[model samples]
Target: MDQVNIEHTPPAVVEYLALRQIAGLSPMSREGAEIGLPNSLFAVCLREEDMLVGMGRVIGDGGCFFQVVDIAVHPDEQGKGYGKLIMSEIMKYLKENVPARALVSLLADVPADRLYAPFGFEYTSPKSEGMWWRQGE
Candidate 1:
């Protein structure tokens, strides 16, 4: 596997979202607008041969807390640590860019939680449970 070519930019972000949609992690249309890139997201993207391979994003409040969202890698490119590479960069950014005491959270997808464990993330459960009330649910 080739080393991941990571970047934070419009094109890279669009690529990331497209790959995430393909991975079934993102809504198919995003309200009929793919303006995710160069719009408001800050992304850590991995690309090869103009192909979007992997990426992760930080979304939500600019301060206080942020959700680690949309981490995805193309199926053909999953075993090469590309997702880890994207995650590592996102974590690094949170550590360096966000305030020291700010909270960062992610909805881990099963085995993927193990990847975040090494980054000092732990279960909030057994202490405090997670709850959500989506707009329509």
Candidate 2:
């Protein structure tokens, strides 16, 4: 945790996919990452001695809608406050760049949901529920 450096850039596609798998997030295709990572509104990569140990990203239209996504940390690196570190950089970007009317959102996988709360993210349920449709279901 001492020497982990924060880079305000997305991880390489290979590191992105590998970290997602190790962190237990749903798999994303390499093609998708190649297209998506460069389109990030903002991204943070936490590296210890140049090895990516954690990352997060914001993706959306420049003004209207933005989503906080791909929050992942290598299993060996979790619980050392790296997730919070990633989110902190993300929140800084949002505060500086996003308009007040722009909506920022994320789907939190439980327990991890706790990590997002202090950053001011909240549930949009009952009033509005989260639903999804997969490409090849």
Q: Which sections of candidate 1 miss by over 4 Å? A: 10-17, 26-28, 32-41, 135-137
Q: Write the per-residue lDDT of candidate 2 for residues 27-93, one digit (tens) a residue.
A: 9999999999999989999998978999999999979899999999999998899999999999999
| Model 1 per-residue lDDT tens digits across residues 1-137 | 69657787534444555776787774534442355444444677678967777777787677888888778888888789887787788878787778878888888878778888888889998998877764441
Given candidate 1, what's the lDDT at residue 37?
48
Lowest lDDT 10-residue stretch of candidate 1:
28-37
Residue 29 shift from truth in candidate 1, angstroms: 3.1
Alpha carbon deviation, residue 49, candidate 1 (Å): 1.4
TM-score of 1: 0.82
Would you give me the overall lDDT of model 1?
0.72
CA shift of 52, model 1, Å? 0.4
